[model samples]
Each structure stands twice: as C-alpha cells, then as structure tokens.
Target chain A: MYFLAIGLIYLAVGGDPAGIVALLMASGLGGLIAGFAWHFGRRYGTRVEDLQDSDAPDATGVVGVYPTASLRPIALAFGTTLLVLGVPIGSWMSMIGAAIVASQVLLLVHDTDD
Target chain B: MTTIDRKPSAPTVTLGGDDPNHLVSIDSVIGPSGQEGTGLPTTLVGWLTTTNHKALGVAYFVASLTFLAIGGGLAGIIRAELTSPGQQVVSEQVYNQVFTIHGSVMVFLFAVPFGFGLANYIMPLQIGAPDLAFPRLNAFSFWLYVIGGAVMLFGFAADGGAAPFGWFAYPPLSGASGSPGLGADMWIVAIILTGTSGTLTAVNVIATITMLRTPGMTLFRMPILTWNLLVTAFMVLVVFPVLSGALLMLLADRQFGTKFYVPTDGGSPILWQHLFWFFGHPEVYIVALPFFGVVTEIFPVFARRPVFGYKGLIFATLTIGALSTSVWAHHMFVTGEVVVTFFALTSSLIAIPTGVKVFNWMGSMYGGAITFEAPMKFAIGFLVTFVVGGVTGVMLASPTLDFQLSDSFFVVAHFHYVMGGTVVIALFAGIYFWWPKVTGRMLSERLATWHFWLLMIGFNMTFFFMHLLGREGMPRRVPDYEPISNWELWNQLATAGYVILLISMVPFLIAVVKSLRGPANAGADPWNAYSLEWATTSPPVEHNFEWIPPIRSERPVFDFRWINHDDVGAPGVAEAWMAREGLDDRWLPLAGPVAADVADDANAASSADSDVG
Candidate 1:
C-alpha cells in the first residue's frame, strides 16, 4: 500500500516519476513476496519442540519456544513495514528485506515434522 | 571404531602391509631405508595410480612451494617495474602482463595452495580419518590446478604476449576490441579450470568434515583449523561456480563473438564487476580466513590456554562467511551505481563478527602463560597485523571513504596488509608449527626469528607509505609515471621494501634446509600438542593414524591422556583444549566414480545445451 502511494505520488509529483514508480513497484513486490514466504515458513517450519531434543546451540533458542501464530501477525507487520521503506532506497534494500522475509519463512516452514 | 597398534613405540609399518589399518597396500615394497624416509612402494604403478592422501598431500606441498617461488619472482618483477616508474624498467604493455600474471599467480596458486597444503596434509589426521572423502578428486583437483596454471603461464609466450588486462579482467576492456588477443582467452580458460578444481576440492573437504568424523565427534567438536576450513570450503562452493560461469560466459564472448561484456555489442561492463566481485569478495576470505584459523589455532597452543569463547569463535566464523557475500558491492561504491546505504550497512556489519573473532583471540591470550616461540611470534604478529587490516577494511567498506580510495594505492596497501602481512605471516606460523610433523624434523628457531623480523620490517616498510601515496592521489596499475608525480620517492621506498622482503626469504630457506638435514628428533608430540594428528608419529605413515578410536571430543587423543593419566591440566592448556575437540575415526567415504560421474554429467549437460543452442 505504501508502495502504491509512492507510485501515485511519483505519478502526481512528476520528474522521472515512472522510473521512480517502477523502481518502487519492483522493490515493493519483491519485499511482499519475501515477507509472505517468511510468514509461511515461520508458521509451518521448525518449532520450539523440534529443537528441544537437540543439544545444538542456536541463536534462535530464545525465540523458538514462542507459538508460530502468535509471532506471525507481528512478523508480517514488520516485514510489510520494511518492504514499504526498502523500496525508496533502491533495489539492494528491497532485496535485503526480501531475504529477511525468505529466511523467516524458512525458519517457520522448513520443519521435519510435516 | 577399529584399533591397530601402529603406536609411536612400535616399528613403522608399510601402508598396505598386514596391518588392518593399511588399505592401499603399498607397504610390502618399502626398501630397508624406507623406515627413515617416505614408505613409498618401489613401483611406477604405486606412484601413478595410488589413491594415498598422504602422497597427494606431498604433491600439493611441492606444487604450492614451486608456485610460491614463481609468484614471488613475479612480485619482484612488478615491484621492480614500479620502482622508479617510467619506461626505464619495462614497456607499459609488458608491465601490464607481468602484474596481471603476478596477481593471478600469487592469489590463486601461491596463497590458496599454501593453505590447502596444510589442510591436505593435516585435516584427515587431525580428524582421525584415514583419508579425504574423495581421494581421487583430491588428486584430480591438484592435477587440474597444475594443468590450468601451466596453461595460463603458457599465455606469456603466446603470439600476442601474456594477458595485459588486469587480473579482474573487467569487460569492455577484455572484450574483442580491447584485448583482441588470445592472452585474455588463455586466462579465462585457465581460471575457469582452476575454479572447477576449487569447487571439487571444496565439496570433497566439506563432505569429509561433515560425514567422516570419528564417533562422538560432533560439529562443535572440530578443531578451529578444521572449522575454518569447513567454512572456507563452503565459501568456495558458493563462489567458485559463479566465477566458473562468469569466465565461461566471457570465454564464449571472446571465442564466438558473443557480447556478454562488450558495451558496443550491448554488453554491460558493470555486469563483469558484479560477477567478478561475487567471486572476488569471497576469494579474499578464501585466502585470508584460513590464515585467521591458522593463527587462531596456534595462539591457544603457545599461550597455554583454552581458546576463549570457542563457541563464539565458531559462530563468528560462520557469520563472517555468510556476511562476506552481501558486502561485495562495497567494492563498487566508487562507481556510484551501487545502492549506497545497503552496501555500506552490510560492509560495516561485517565488523561485528570480525570484532568477535578479535576479542576471542585476545581473550584466549589474556592471563595465560604465554610463550613467544617462533610460531607464537608469527601468531602474535597475525593478531596485530590482521587487526590493523580489519580496521582499515571496515573504514574502506564505507562508500564515503571508498569513493576517495578506490583504484588508489590505499586499496593496494589495504589488501597487501591483510593478504601479505596477515595471511602470509600466519601461513609461516603454521609452517613453523607443523614443519616438525610434516618432515619429522625441527626448523632452527634462530633462523626463524631472523626470517620473522625481516618479514615484519620489510612488509610494513613496503606498504605503510602507500597510505600516503593514495592520499596524494596516485593511481594503481600504471606502468610508468612522469617525474612530477611526487610518487617517485615513496615508490622507491616501497620497492626497497620488496627487496628487503625478498632477502628475508633467505633465512626461511635456510631454516627449512636445516630442519630437513638436521635430525629426526620430533617425537609424536614435540610441542606436547593435543590434537589427534600429534598422537601419531612424525611424518605419519600412509594411513596416518593406526588405532581408530571413537572420538569423545575435538581432542580425542588428548582426551585419552586426560582420562587415562588424569592429566587434565596439561602443560599447554590450549593444546589440551584443541585435543578435547577431537573426532572419532572413520574411513573417508571416497568413491572415485562419484566425482567422475558428476564431471561427466556436467559435461554432458553443457554439450547438450550447446547442441540445442
């Protein structure tokens, strides 16, 4: 939505607005995809219970125990916000945000439990 | 899982003798003198087709040293040319070729092979494994490297002279109109072949580390050196394929008039930078990070303390590896095409993990009974020099500063500080540390000290002034400069430093000669080290270790001593800590056909794709 607004503003404000809008749109779209992927993975991937049995030390141990659904809305919101902000800066930021989203999804959904 | 007593107290057994540990079967033909020398079977068959990892390691060491000398000579030529500047030394064209080849040889052949020489010779023994996971691929990789190196050097004698393009070979410059010669083509072919060797070697090492550990040895239990190599192998796997692909595409452009990089032909020059840095950024780590591991491994041993924050150091290693890819675009900040904040943030972000490593090393050294042996001296030197290099690296990672320093002597100074100063220094440390094991003898500490001081003084003198040169706005890769450039005096100083560094090699050579000719004095553990490799005799037999024990920790053999003898507080606490992380013994799961199959499949796919195209 923020990306759409940026596009509309670019269209309405003038001076390479199309290029700006296109850049924003591309970046925005990338971020959205990434966020969704992360959300999905977080929802379905490895859970706290899965890691409980292993002795492997992980950074996410603290965050692991939280219920997936409980974390989802917040993650989605955060990712969306990052996606919106990342577009204006350039492709690299959007890609970073996208990676974050993707990794989140991997964390959420790449579970052995099926 | 199996115990065969080829203990230090017993007479040496042939590799393929009646001992159950012997599998390759070359022990029977070892002549009477073989007890004192390489227990190599007296047969052409054994030398050529034998899959002995120890033999392969010897080959790597020999090849690495030969390339080191060649690369050093190339460096001398480059420094000589830059001495006074102007055409007084060599032609501009010839200088271009010389430096290009020099950089290529030093980075690809010298520094890289130096690390691998240690890894190849030591990793399996340290892990309590008999051989690497894919021994044939190890041999194949070594051959391919030699073949590729030879081919690239052959380009020097090509009809148009060697490749005059910079080592990076950025496109448009390397394109048909820019190069118009086969020299560039030879470089492309050679490096692509080399990249393939790297990728294969990486895969083999990774597989070996992951799958072949002795029982009870987990990932966290691996030694710091092995852990570093593990991370480096993964880095190589991720980056080398991209380099291979990029070079292949470049080769296609040159040979078949494809316009992948020719701007007039709609090729993007920036694309080449992207591709090159994709490999190039990680390539720096590929060369330096192992030395970081080398020095890190040595510090604890000499300091007589456990490696501080072993787990944190492991995390830092992995983090550095992952973050390395994201920061490649920092190299492009001068071009202004890169996303500034994105790269800047990532570049600065790397400092966090690097800082962790520095802290860990310092912590390891703190309050410990430190002994500044020759190896210890080099290790300490690594800490100091690498910190300076790392700090400067963080500074350059900023786009704001990078814009001013790119293509300047500052860039050269920065890299040489890390690569030449830190990595090479650490490599010497590793050499000094392991020379007794590899050769069954000890290097002279007196000569080693001489070597160390000269290297330190000469290296700093050569590169320290370059900071000023860059500040004064001198450009790099130029063969000649006018008298008025103000870089003449600094250039002469830097050149003199190179000469000093060259002279420093003499003491090092003398030390090596003294070690080989001196005595067979290094017992199983002359340093009283803790790792599994030291549990075996100096210059380990073909199978390395005889009794394959279930590894309870990273320091398996060291653990045995502690458990059996109740010596938890060893003389060198760090060595004990390293030994405590030893792995259980397992045979490397090397099936030669697997690599052969993969190469075949890849070749088939490429040929099929070509046919379809």
Candidate 2:
C-alpha cells in the first residue's frame, strides 16, 4: 500500500510513468517478500512449546546465579562520564575526580554472587 | 611461598525446583502441553511484552531488511542518474543528495544494524541464555533506532529536505551558512539518536554475553557469532560515542552560534574530520565483524565440519576490533592533519589479522564435505569479495596510494566491495540460513538460486568497473560529468547492473510469497544442526520453550539426541536447573542500571570473601 501510494504520488507529480512502474514493482515485490518472510517465520520459527517445562527440574538442589541486575547502570555511568567530558564542570581535575567517583560507585555494588 | 590459587565458591544447590547452583534442566520451568513456555512469550505478548534474545534477534533482522529495501531503492535512483551522466535525469544537486543519502542509509541505517540485529537475536540463544541482561533497555535501544532513523528520513520531507552532504555529512559543506537547511540538521540529530541507540545496545549485549552465560558456557566455548557480537558490542561502546559527540557538536554549530568547526571563531573544520573518522573507521568494522561472525557460523554448518582454528578466529576477531580503533586516520591520509606514517603503519598491520581470518575460513573448508547451499554460496561469495575489498583497503591504507585515491571513486569502489559486496552478501546468507528457524517454513530453493546468481553478477557489474572509473580520475559526490571523459561506459554498465540487480530481487519476493502460502513445513532441526536453538520447534512458541531442557555441550539438541533419549516430562527434576540457566521472564534485564550494579556487587562479594578467608 505504501509503495502504491508513493507510485501514485509520483505519477501525480508528473514523474515518468515507466519509472513509477518500476518503483511500484520494486516496492510491491519487496513488501510481498517481507510479509511472507514474517508469515513463515511465525509458522516455522522457534516456539515456546518446544522447550522443556519451565517449572520442572531434572536435577536436584542446583542453584544458578546470573549477573545481578545492575550491569546497565554501570555502563550508563561510564557513558555519562564520556558525555561529561564535553562540559566544563571544572578543569581536567574535575574530569578525573568524576571518573574516580563513578568507578568507585560501580565497584561497590553487584558482586559476582554467581 | 606462592599462595595456591583456588576457584571461587559455587552457589547453593537444591533438587528439582529453583536451585541456584544448577542452571540446566528442562522439567522445572515452562511446563508442558499448553503451559506457558520458559522462553519469553509466543503470542502477541511474547513479541510485544517479552524479552527473549532470540525474539529480539528476529526483530532486528526484520527491521534491517525493511531498511535494506528502502536503501536499495535509493540506490536505484542514484544508478538511474549516473546511467548516462549528462543532466538527462534529475538535477545535479538532487543527484548528489540521492547518492549521499543512498550511501548513508545503506551503511549506517542498513548495514550496521544488519549485524547487530543478527547478533541480538541469536547470540544469547547460541550461548544458552534465555534473555539479555538488560531487556527493557534493549527495547529502548531499538525504539531509539526507529525514532532516529525516521527523524533522519523525515528531514527529507521537511522544508529544506533530507541531507545531501553525504553519509559523513562533512562540515563547512554541511553547515547552515553553506547548506542552510533542516535536512543536515535532521541528519545530525537523527544520527546522534541512532548513535546513542548503538552505544546503549552495545553495552547491553556486552554485559549479557559477559555475565549471563549458562553453566559451562564459558567464553572460549561460545559460538563464533557470539564472540563476534561480543567484540562488536565492545567496539560499539567505544566508537559510537565519538560519533555521537561529533554529531551533537555539529548540531550545535549548525543550529546555534557554536564555533566547533568555524575557523574564524577558533574552531577548525579539520577537527570535525578527525572526530568523524575516529568513529567512522571502526564503524566500518562494526558493520563487517558481525558478518564475519555470520560467515563463521554458516561455513561450518554447510561444510558439515567444526570450525578450524577457533581460537585463532577469536583472536583475529579481537585483533580487528582493537586495531580498527587505531587506524581511523587512514581515511584522512590526504587531510595532512594526520600523522601519515602512524596511520599508514597501523592501517597496513590490520591486514594481518584479516588475512588470518581468511586463512582460517579456508582451513575450515579444507577436507570437509562442502555443500553449496544458498547460504554457503553467499558466504563463499563474501570470502571472495571481501578479499578483493580488503586488498583495496590495504592499498588505500598506504599513505602514498591513499593520497592518490582519496576522494576518488576508487575509495567508493573499495568500500562498496567491502561493505556492499561482502557484508550485504553475508546478510543474505544469514537470512537464508536462519529463515527456516525464524519462519518455520523454507524459502524456494530455486528462487534462492536465482537471487544468488543475479546478486553476485549484478553486484560485480556495478562495482568492479568503478575501480577503473575511479582510477581514471572521476571523483565521488559529483552529479554530472563532462561528456569527453571515458567514465560514460562504466557508468552505463553500472546502471544496467543496478537494473539487473533490481530484477534479481524479484524472484526472492515471489519465492517468499509462494512459500508462505504453500504447504512447506520446517520441522525442528531441519538441517540436522548442532545448537540449543535447534532443540525447539520450528517457529518457536511465545515464551521460547515449554520446559528449560538440560544443556551439556553448546549443541544441546544434538546432545539430547545422542544422550538420554527419554522425554524429560513437565515438572521433571531438570526444570529447576533450566530456569536457573535460562533467561528471566522479562527480556530487558540490564539496560537500566545493571552494568553499574554488577561491578559493585562483584567488588563487594570479593571483599567479603577475602575478609572471611
């Protein structure tokens, strides 16, 4: 629909009929492919049912530990540090001090319980 | 006496349900038969509210392909103009803008996202995790991409129109006084937003890969795709911000009275170049490495052999990431601000690692039962084209050669070979390889074959002659050329190639539509694959799995086939371990503040341990 709309718009604007035809063909074809890809993807792609039951365990008393949920914040903090370099809160010393404080805060949380 | 090193204490263990120490089993989570699977969600909720790494991967792939088609259409416009190159088509300025947006859209919006999408969807699943550490942030990052990309394009619909300053949006030319339009500003803001998305997503993926692996899924044991993604994520964190910073400054310069680039106001335009390339060079690898990973994934699968020199491949991947950062000045060899020798040396050295990878890929195929599946064909196509591109890159890397070739179509030709020829081919290969996994149905092999041939032929026809044209002193970014130049023949041939390429894409479309309506079914493990992903059904349900199955090797499905053949029933002893091993219910785990918190937690945990000892 988007392609056809664009093609019609092109024609309305006095674009070459042949060019408009070519473009519509390209877009219509691309959209068809994408739609089918999604359809088949939905049908044949991995589904939840194939996996083992979520609540049951084959083994006894085995605990798994993933990273505690604080990793993104540290990364954001680091990003913030870089962003702050663009500003002049202080001289180079201010930048250094801020970096130290951010690093220390990151270090103080989320120890590897896993 | 040296203190004897000891491993850290393992987590607590319990039998069957919610055991913290045991992270592998199928019976505990995601109950059987109509119960919600342990993955993410399978229904609309799974797609809308869920956060599985695999689902995200599929989303990225779909998004990237849409942009690819859009960018390809833009390319068609560019080719049409250059067909005869005499103002027979659009005006010179429109032509310039078309090609510029064409390159920028393809490289930044299309190609860079291509690898990231694949990596996001597949990396965690391949490594036996259920979801990314930062699920919400992942969604946020993707949203940012959509918003940024749209804003950039929307600039076209604006009063001044889309940016025509090329992908780099080089300053002076890009400035308000010079261009005096919102198109460039749109490009600036859009890219800044996009760069932010890239940076955040990189941090998320890196943290997920580093901290969220299942039991025994160590770094070395990870799939090549995951490893490449890891490197890519790291590079994204390092490089994208530089681009973001540059874009912000550029925006300020253009919008406000900021003098970041205005020389009379104590700003140097060359500084903009430095900042841009600082991100630009690595941005190339950022686009390429994931394809390298995809190539790595496809080669062994079709060849029916394990990857050769796995460690070497990993090292080469890492080397490319690190070395890529130092070689940014290679693009600026003619600018004279760069230390020519330093950049030249760094640039030449990058070839060694790239060569190592080529050798390893070939080595992997040696003595193996190689089959020319469509995916493998594309992968092999990448190997051939990328090598040529690499050669050109090496040539351009040289200070003298680059001085000669800089700003010429030669550089354009080289990059198209590398970025367009290689990465785009690999992307097609990845689509073919994972299509069944994503769609639960197979694409028409006949149509796939047609698509491959046309893609290969048309691409070469369009790009190969550009090298010659560029060598003949035709520079890029020009709309019309004098009739006396010999560039006409090559340009004509290239335009014809674009037409052919457009034709080639048609069959794939037909195949997609035909297959979707047909009765083809892709059962789980259609290719007899090795990997946890194959264990699930084709087109996995909402919430990936009904039960979290046990994983021994990286190829859990295959291992399941070889080992105990019994069906691990729902609520079996394995469920607890699987839940522990797999992802949480929600997808975005660490995008918020997980990265910062994890380090601190680790530090606190370590100090407590030391104090105890």
Number of the top-ranking candidate, with TM-score as the measure = 1
> Given candidate 1, what's the lDDT at residue B571?
35
Lowest summed lDDT window (length 10), candidate 1 chain B = B582-591
lDDT string, candidate 1, A11-108, tens digits:
45441322343335434643554475478557778532123222111111010011111232224323433442343234575577577666655654
Deviation (Å) of B335 in candidate 2? 1.1
| Cα lDDT tens digits for candidate 1, B1-613 | 1112222211223323464333221112222222233433356555444445676676677777787788788777778887875666678888889888988988887788666766677887776565777665576576667767776787788778778888898887777678876677777767876777777788778767754554434566678888889888877866676677778778778766788877777877777777788678879888877788887778887787778998998899888886676567688887766667766887898899989998999998999999888899998888888887887898898777889999998988888888876667888898899888788898889999999999888888898888878878888888777655568899888989888888899999988877888878676666656576776667776556434322445554454444323355333322322332311111111212243343355457768988999
* Model 2 misplacement above 4 A: A1-114, B1-55, B546-613
lDDT for residue B207 in candidate 1, whole number 0-100: 66
Model 2 chain B: lowest-lDDT 10 consecutive positions:
B1-10
- Using Cα atoms, each model's DockQ against the true complex is 0.02, 0.02
Tens digits of per-residue lDDT for model 2, A1-114: 544664565556564333355436535554654575478558777322223332212211112222322333334433443333223223464466466546644653543424
CA-based DockQ, model 1: 0.02
Q: Model 2's lDDT to the true fold?
A: 0.67
lDDT per residue, candidate 2, B1-613, as tens digits? Answer: 0111111211213233354333333222222224233343457644553345565666677777888888898888777777775777677767766777787778778888777787676776675454676665776566567656776677678676678788887778887687777677667766776787787788788767755564444466578888888888877766676677777788778766799888888987777777787678888899998889888888877777667898999999988986776667677767676567766787899999999999989987888899887888889988999999999999998888888888988988899999986678898888888778777788878889999999889998999889988898888877777765678999988888878788888988898788778663776556656565664555654323333334443445444333322343222323333344423221111112343344455457768988999
Show where candidate 1 strays beyond 4 Å. Answer: A1-114, B1-50, B484-486, B548-550, B564-613
